[model samples]
Target: MNKRTDIISDHVISALGDGSEENFKKLLNNRSGITFHKSGKYSDNTLPLGAIEEELISQRVNGNRLPEGYTRFEKLCILSISEALKGIDIDITSEDTLLVLSTTKGNIDLIENPEMHHKLDLWYSANRIASYFRTKNTPKVISNACISGVSALLYAQWHLKEGNYNHAVVVGADIISKFVVSGFESFMSLSPDICKPFDMRRDGLTLGEAAATIVLSTERKGRVGIVKGATANDANHISGPSRTGEGLYQAIKHTLDDDRQIDFISAHGTATPYNDDMESKAFKRSGLESTTVNGFKAYVGHTLGAAGIVEVIYSVWSMYENMIIKTFGYDEFGVAEKINIADRNIKKELKNVLKTASGFGGCNAAILLKKNE
Candidate 1:
């Protein structure tokens, strides 16, 4: 047993709304933030996307206007971290505090534009965000494909347990760009309409953009905190996940250890045929085929690097509210394995919840959040 890493405060900025509560409220109402996009910004064809309005970003930030010279990506991160830091007692300037940034593509949209090549670097963007808050330490950045959010949280927890830092502000953000959209389009992975996770009509994933932040400390600052986390790679194809679900299962097995009684699971249900099927197989392999599971993608539209942190924040809200939100677009159990996918809101006591993520390069991550005793 190690010192527990507890979440202090958290925030989420998505198409649903600003704060975690706002987004959770929409979930309770079965409202989705996904919208149809016909703009030529992402692609030539119309696509479904979960993008935050520029006006919202510009208006909700600290100054009601984005700071000069800061890219949209940087501003979104700052806004999320700033909201999470509101009224908290943590001294971000203290050397005992660390900042960790998680994003698959940080300022990657600047690649095509000139005179900002340095801003294209993830570290540069991370430092900019940290400097905005006057943090003393050089920020750590994680860019592990789609699992960056969970990976960043795991890194913070490991360092906190080791007494390297007293507090860590982990923020994950990613915005959809022409470059990113075109890459996914090349693979034909984007859904033409709202995604259907684990549903028979599911075809492809809907891309999304968002920034989510979570503050963690060794002390119990909140009612829920991370208990354990693990990661495993199955050495599968670059874009395709393991069909047997061995990687995700191994990660789940290691994360749960002796405690297999998970109240529910926040799955990485991308709505793609392979991802949902693999996750189902993994749940079956872990003997958790009966645990209620739900995917947040239907609401947030697969927010790339932010998916892990965003979904984690939503899961925390579920624990606090003691309600499991339904899989938004799932009306049928379409996965190959017979897993219990939550199609309706479930009001049950949640003491422990499992959050799982799988990404490119055969990466899989699982983290357990337990109600503080």
Candidate 2:
């Protein structure tokens, strides 16, 4: 029997050109994507966010040869996966390669326009991308609220360990629409400006859309490796996390206990009061209070279902560059926990890192990764 290691061969992260480098120097220097759209009915009180440059999307699609009828989510997924696999000289045979897609609302925009309602089918979205790449294996789609992206990675790890597949492509995407905007507005979760995580003035989340993809395999070469991973549910609350953050704390403890030298942590700091407070409690309970922690929501806003995978890409890239990216809008820590919130860029040699996330239904997941030598 061969021992298996969770190895990430390559990864591609898609963000608005403006939110990324080149057009903007860094996240801290760019204007927030949150804006008011007072033309629509919900616009009176709701703020709509649109970040990606249309021309950039066009360029990516043309370069990747994506189909014209593909929805925004599909196009983003195809582009990110294509880029992530570029120059990778791996032979993926039929039945050996798998594709897992994670999204909260797949093609939900099609439903808004009755003429395109039929195009919103989840199977079609999954198969279209698989067929485009000429993969004979059927793709798997997971829509587990906000944790869908991280769950996809967990599923891939299990299947690889079981020898069901040799490699897997995990992609996550979700686009903003009237449906998503209005729903969050109804819940009073949308902030009028960019989100400020762990701040006394924090209000709500700023919605953003993105697609991030990563290639995972049992083979480890020229890639970062997943050292450990664990998932748990509080079973204590239906719509919110347990006040004590029991599930999150357990997930963190499980990941760290296996390897105690985890240097950095990428927190799911959505900037929402309750979520941020619960995560702060979890960090303290896990005894990782001294570890450097940071949030990426300020840079890309909260990408709903795509947050897990997108943040994973950021964490890996930060390690690769040997720099810890700043938590753009963080100002203060309001929690009672003694946490090290990273408010400035720091250069450090990171050996192992932990990425933690929690979602609706009290679902929590934590993954540990080691930088490749």
Candidate 3:
């Protein structure tokens, strides 16, 4: 398949199990892992979110050290990737393997506690995760807001394509903290209830936390392959996207141009009016109106940095099962340009699929995957 340079060997997705089984089952039910955080010291007026239960996190890892106790990002990364790599055979030498992590707020949870915050730093958090697997390669961490996860994937793909490494482990994760919640609250971008993406009644986003990981290699098996990937910046605004979605449109166009038949698209769908409108416009501009579009934000809320790889996991799983999951809270179309959203479970054989992500700083990324033949 186009003389594959890099292929995804396995993907592992982790979420709180308190939600619907269908939500946790696979990619088709559109179930979100969000729940009400009654223990936090936030205002009750805040919206519900897809927060992983503390009990679940505790069950996965055991320790009281700062890296183990305060670094939620590291813990989630270790748990998620460790599960994803279960039973997979790989030869990881320092020169042949690398570990790439993407996160917007790496171990910000340490900052929540004044005592821990004073002692923790960026390198400690980044290295803690890398040391978990005893990876000898210098761990690379990308903190490019929401686009970090996809950026990590793109970096791994480039390295593999260039024959720099034989294998790479990519992990994306973030945790809910008062800092992030308050940041979104200050921006007035948080939804008070369930997020309704591309719907007439859409309001804002519900921030969530999750960890998703993927193993990439230059070997192909019965799995998905990275066909194409592109990243671009709008250079328009820092916190806001371009009105016309120039970056997103370009990213999607370039990816689709490389492969004409894109069976499904995993949309960013943050449920914010601006992001949804921009994404819908980008899809229309790319002539992807007829392609099956799916959104995982509704199911997982906006996982910030983790959303990129989290959504990719959903897209890959959809391809594995030959089914398209509907957007969870979407009911009516509100955008001026009409684009197709997978509103119901549809079983269809898919070959080429596109996963797109956008974040602050006007950054946009699109990754294409083709089903194994």
Candidate 4:
């Protein structure tokens, strides 16, 4: 028999809130975490961002006292993982358990400080997180551009199905910093206002910071589980995505079975012209142009490495609530093909959902999730 892997428990700490359910509640209430910033902390230019307060981070984790030596990046991972573990009985130290860290730039904030170069290694951060939790296995680290989170989850699922481990703790995070902000600014991809996904007036993406963890176990079934997943790289450009949506189309085609219907799509709608256009073309080619779709970037901004996992967790919450949220900044449809962009919240049965992500280096991924019967 093939082992089944299911998402058991999860937690999210973003500008919106700390818990996964808490963030979902704020979304339902039409509260956005993205706010315009005047301070030159992250970037020299004033722009809107989904940033969490430093004081809040210091006071929210581990009874208001975080352990010593962990960077801000590490702190976010530990706090999120700790809270997620509260809902599950799986032992982190068990030999059958595995830990995985997903991030695009772990401790990249320390790049300017040459003396702190030791903390710049991604492996060091992953090892530190594993050591903090006393896990028996060396944690796996994935830094696959913006697809890190989804890649990590898919990787964990593969391991669980292969009987290499029974449980997998996957955490994806990236904190806002000068290095991160400047890079986007250079790309001219930082929006001055809240991001608008699939809107005619859409401009650029808003950057955000977050850490999200999802625990997957093969030992038992949960409310929802990943049914199929596939990744494809078009090798279109070093930093630009394929304009034809070739990679994403391939991923969606591979992930969906012939008879399965996708109720809605959690799109990688970054609000950029090329990305939104490419996604629309991909959905059209996959014969899903009319399927309802929504993007969470307007609420929490584009959360780098955490975007995939964060969006997936919110999708799960929507499935449980039996509702689909409107794209926050989306009003008029603007993509090349006609796709159903949710302009209003609709309550309905979301039995099967598709989550997709596209990133630089022409990477695209799709994951099909089903509500367990």
Task: Flag the better candidate by TM-score, 1 or 2.
Answer: 1
Candidates in order, TM-scores: namely: 0.98, 0.91, 0.91, 0.98
| Maximum-lDDT candidate | 1
Q: Mind sharing the TM-score for model 4?
A: 0.98
lDDT of 2 by residue, 1-373 (tens): 2435545544433444522233123443534444455646334564646445567778888877776878887887788778767767544436788898888887887776898887688777888888778886889988777777777887887788788888888888887777887788887887787788777677888877777777788864645766667888988987777788888898888777845676899998888888888888898888788889988887767787778887777777677766777776788777557688887887888878899988888988898878866
Candidate 3 residues 236-316, lDDT tens each? 999987788899988877776745688898898888889888888888888888888878887778888878887777777
Between 1 and 3, whose TM-score is larger? 1
Give the Cα error of residue 78 in candidate 4, in Å: 0.1
Task: Output the worst ten-in-a-row residue range by lDDT, candidate 3.
Answer: 15-24
lDDT of 1 by residue, 95-213 (tens): 98989999998998888888888899999999898888899999999999988899999999999999999899999999989999899889888778789999988998998999999
* lDDT (C-alpha, whole model) for all candidates: 0.91, 0.75, 0.76, 0.89
Candidate 4 per-residue C-alpha lDDT over 1-373 given as tens digits, one digit per residue, 9 for 90 to 100: 2777888999999989888988999888878899898867787788999987677678776574667888899999999998899957899999999999989999999998999999999999999999999999999998888888888899998999889999999999988889989989999988788999999988899999999999999996689998778889977887887878899999898899584588989999999988998999999989998889999989888888999999999999999998888789898889988888988888889999999999988899999888988
Candidates sorted by lDDT, best first: 1, 4, 3, 2
lDDT of 2: 0.75
Q: In model 1, how large is the Cα lDDT of residue 85?
A: 89
**What's the C-alpha lDDT at position 80 in model 4?**
91
lDDT of 4: 0.89
